[model samples]
Target chain A: MSDAASVQAVRATVGDSEFDRDTAPTRRAPGVYDIDLSAGWTILGAVNGGYLLAVLGRALADALPHGDPFTISAHYLTASKPGPAVVRTDVVRTGRTLSTGQASLFQYDDEGHEVERIRVLASYGDLDTLPDDVRTAAEPPAFPPMEHCFGPEDGPAPAAGTSAIADRLMLKLDPSTLGWALGAPSGKGEMRSWFGLADGRDADPFSLLLAVDALPPTAFEIGLSGWVPTVELTVHVRCRPAPGPLRVSITTRNLAGGFLEEDAEVWDSADRLVAQSRQLARVRLG
Target chain B: MSDAASVQAVRATVGDSEFDRDTAPTRRAPGVYDIDLSAGWTILGAVNGGYLLAVLGRALADALPHGDPFTISAHYLTASKPGPAVVRTDVVRTGRTLSTGQASLFQYDDEGHEVERIRVLASYGDLDTLPDDVRTAAEPPAFPPMEHCFGPEDGPAPAAGTSAIADRLMLKLDPSTLGWALGAPSGKGEMRSWFGLADGRDADPFSLLLAVDALPPTAFEIGLSGWVPTVELTVHVRCRPAPGPLRVSITTRNLAGGFLEEDAEVWDSADRLVAQSRQLARVRLG
Candidate 1:
């Protein structure tokens, strides 16, 4: 089948999927998953870290005694490729409120050697059981209303990059953030955008794995370009997102010794803080 | 021997050791070591997250094919207790620039069952090999000179917090940030302190594990505080810290539905940014 035919068939049969079915896993045992990779997930010869984490997180969430991820941290040891690998999880603790576990992704080599790639520790708890809402400080970023925002229908494809991850996630970047991408670099290191799946699926804990890191590197907006690899990323789920457009913002307070910090917070249409993330990344000279 | 006799014997022989000497291992085996927990490191009968992480980090740093930890993240699953446990490390990838690995701390129950209590992912690289510094942004936090600042030597011990970990570490909080501890709560959720080992050891990658999370939970300085346990913590070692004092500050921007985020930055006496950390913790109303 041609590329167009495959795309049409996917649209007709499966209305929405963050990743291809080939990358899906088979759970032959407890806390273990046998997963096959798909080339479609690769951005530029390497699988997107956020996407990889979402899939890995799904495996852990499904295997754990509890289901929802309250806090998760993933370290990208290497670029996971399109091949066979296994995800393993170890139970750390199971409490009345929160359960903690460690998940790892492993790929077998030619001599039947298992090489670990990505590892994470996540705390799981029911979103419904959150302590009664009592917010004393901090407010969500102010974003333009939906009518004024720019979606894919209102603009051209992202011409500055050819990333598959970008194609899968539709972004309505704040006009102020777009100037830097067009070569009129903004010295400020920050990114603000409205985000949702391209196919229009409501996000769950898994998709949030990708959403938290969806914004372009804040450094790109600060005159530094090229690939800014994230050394470590940590996300905390404050609450399950309410359906509709998710507002996202990322800011860098310090760019020192060739490294920068990216701090992000995600809010739902209901104006509830859904997730918060922080990452440490090295800036490449472009 | 009387309690005083044993204390005198220990002071004469062991000098400064939080963990037991019997738990120390030879260099032949990387990542496999029997560890004994010390009650002295416990805060309210449970091991302090920062102190436990420091021990775990030492094992990983010593066992790694390379011996430097530039970035490390730890998730507290169970409150580690006084008992026997083991530290295990898995090589994720050994690269030219950065090497990554995962370390797990396991504690056994009375029935001989092993349970994972803490897990971390650490990236290692030689401090001397970092690219020539080109940080045009992010100046260090402005602070007063040492002579003008206060030290714990000039103040009273923390009130009624029977934590030996407290005795092991000394903190000199900024006067502006000390209102909360005295019952005159500072409505602000922030903490800034000058830190050094009570035993006088210069800060290193291991001590930094303790240093980054050493600040009192950001919630305490705010109006809420009974016990705010950290669910997850991440630290980035930007550069080798210079000799002398260390400045640490933690601030929480949002307090929503009983959860708050703490962002921390650490600067060495040389005014170089040595490390940065962030943690998510549940708020306890005092």
Candidate 2:
């Protein structure tokens, strides 16, 4: 491709949207922000839950002076859309070691009335001050080295289709688990991958949110497909990730009464468990 | 002990305070209730996280038309005290399968001002309609039968002491993980126990909340002691548990700078994964 064509292709890959939400500010209000969600931060129909949390995190970081969010649990009341939305923050408590706050993202209806969409409860603290306890029983459940995982750069064009959010994130999944993307699921109820931010912004709490739910719905690997909408999601940041790629492992152990549960654990390249999260989702079938 | 004394002991074991919480309503108001959280609910000068969640669950159930909560993620912004506190709930959404709401528990100070202590986001869901999908890849980690595990009922009586929450709940732990109570702390970073509502109330969503955080902090098994207050907790109820005991497995995968992570999995008597939860806590040291 020519230099000019290559530049155009790069823009197309990023979908003219954004991955580093830290840079997506459009209009700033006193305690609210009209942030640009861009068009590419989604999968299928709804916006990606993690990417949404990152947006909330950026707005939250500005609202609280303690530090960036070290813990954020987001409840997806409804599916959010791309484009400009309002982020309104409210400080709940300011403790000696931690600060608690809540942020809501909404967009105005055609009638100019605000419609609330996502709600997040965030806790901010000094990540650098965390203890150096090296004793833990968890390591990102073992996976093959990154060289073997098939990602967008080294693999064939996506067979299940890719969206704007896909461009900003690099999730090179273990081949065996990506069978479902080709309409052939391994039937094991697991999704494993090597994940990271596309622009090397260095993994932080914001990316941790998206990374937690970034794995394709584990249901897709267990014979259930289509949009799997999450009703609720909670992410626990164990530590500020040691700047590097994250190992992702998400598995669904139960699919009862049309509802399923996904448990995710993220480990940074340093072999430390940086973040872990779980979500309750409903399986939408044909 | 005489038969009369034994009967009194049994009643004491069940404690006047509740673990199931369905029958523990003491005071009431419109979309609000003053629940009895007895002083016995604390570990070391602070209320247990699960008990706090149950208080929120009661208020949420009354606020929404839905039957109960299957998805309740609680954030412990402050250390709540036990007493006749008020539970105030606000409805966020009313969907067909679920209803979303937030509840805050408050107690008046000597000056008579309502002070908010804990905040909960509850997603009310009907347990009856859940699909009975038993096919799961996760199971209660292997453990000896209840008869083999130790409890306050058997072995050496609890040394760290018991609370009202403890009176209503029986935790016969897998012997391997209970070494810490004796001050030995096998140092395995694991705490496994066979848990249940001692009064035979049948395990429901509220009780499940108590059960998830019921396990003695896994950090105890790793040589860390004292208060260890939970900063945040998120619980996912997979399905209605069978009418019997629950097996709980809580393990800590990381403990850094004054903070630790606890992952809990609860399985019912039928060997079904009934609920799962994770939390971020501060390690209170001597």
Candidate 3:
């Protein structure tokens, strides 16, 4: 079959979920993939960092011998937008337990020049092979049931053409944490929420990448405004998550020199800690 | 002068501190460096991951236009021994605010084939240019003064040929957190300490890299023993640190499938948050 026809066949086989469709990468060569940056996942006109990571994670998963991405660290050099982009992956090392690689997402600029948007280093492994040992010192934060939280559809509607990401995912924020959106900033530098796909797709290791960064900047609760660009983000996927909405808690502990570090922990429906991430981002206050 | 002579001249200019001497890289070319990994910094016969990061960070700081590394994420592919290694850096992007780059530390294996030991991606920037705004939601962990805590020299001397890292730096563990060493595990999954160079050198961005990972793995406090090899480590240097011992706290919140995540925070003498790090590592229990 022709390359285009093969991609079409793969797309037909994928689930109807928007995440599956948008993050699906068509292999162009051994380590190159062509991905379409879907417009449905954006914050302030720029593609969401986690969503972009999911796209890169998909490409890495396809290129590497391993089936799951265990750890991924991405550096966002430039903001990316919705369009066609190419992801080039390089397998750095293929170990017995883990395979390591790097991927860079490139998009065409206004001058028709290919510019690098995001660079990522990830290690892929078989999550099923991990030892079934569990120990927890941190408990999942206390959060109300999904219905009691402030969901994406709960607040005053965002102006048209803004916050496209809200339409793509089911994000139910803790009502108390949404005071920032209601003109009464919490000043607590924390936001807790329940997250899942709107299309009822099961959350997997790949989608957990998106869940880690899907929340609004915790800085927003402290009354900081404007764009908060992530400089670096690192996520460790602990295990395959249970099928349900994930519980997520993000907090900004220190904001110094306009740069804040946000730490996120994701728990599966079984109350298992599935993923943890920390990101350094700039709070571009106007 | 020839390259060898130039390297010697450069070495002569470095401070007498072991950290400064060992981490100082000699540029072999525009983006290539030759470094000698000092034997003084080792834990359980393997080179410390943070010390290795410092070496790579030095190479990157030399190649990049920026002065200090603000963010660095490194994947430990293989454990490296003290010896000569080559670091090759690639300037990914040199933005006005931050210059991003990648560096790989390679060493010749026993089979005479060069093997990669560590791969790093870092962004360098001028800390002076950062805004003076400081708003912290997380306070430094409380601990006894440095002299009151359990200093490295206070404990039973490590049997000869073990823990070379102990002689290289001053580490005072919070007495309450050292129950694991006394056969009574804290079960808290936390380790707090005061860290500084034994040579009295003040900690900087580069040295802070080592300081972040200098403490014993928090798993030891929870009774999980044996080697804990870090799979991936990421450090965010928040600002220039004041000259004094740094207060550091590292905690493991969750451990699943023999893999654990440790989050560390470093506060400088001024009580300013200077750096934060999170690493994913395996708890190799025999």
Please give, for residues B184-249, the per-residue lDDT of candidate 1 as tens digits. 768787788888766555677666777877766767667776778888888887778876768888
Best prediction by DockQ: 3
lDDT of 2 by residue, B75-121 (tens): 78766777767887788888898888888888778898987788888
Which of the two, 1 or 2, has more TM-score? 2
Supply the TM-score for candidate 2. Answer: 0.90
TM-score of decoy 3: 0.94
Relative to the unseen true structure, what is the C-alpha lDDT of residue A151 in candidate 2, on a scale of 0 to 100?
Answer: 68
Of the two candidates 1 and 3, the one with more favorable DockQ, higher being better, is 3
DockQ of each: 0.47, 0.65, 0.72
Q: Candidate 2, chain A: TM-score?
A: 0.88
Model 3 Cα displacement at A226 (Å)? 1.5
- Candidate 2 whole-model C-alpha lDDT, 0 to 1: 0.77
- Residue-by-residue lDDT tens digits, candidate 3, A1-286: 9997665454222256778889999999899999999989988788999999999999999888997988899999998989999999999999898999999999998899999999999988999998887888878899999889876577572422478888767888888888877878889989899998876787999889999998878988988877889999999999899887899999998998879998999999998999999999988755
Q: Which residue segments of model 2 deviate by more than 4 Å?
A: A1-17, A21-28, A153-161, B1-29, B160-162
Candidate 1 clash pair list: none
lDDT of every predicted structure (CA atoms): 0.74, 0.77, 0.88
Superior candidate under lDDT, 1 versus 2: 2
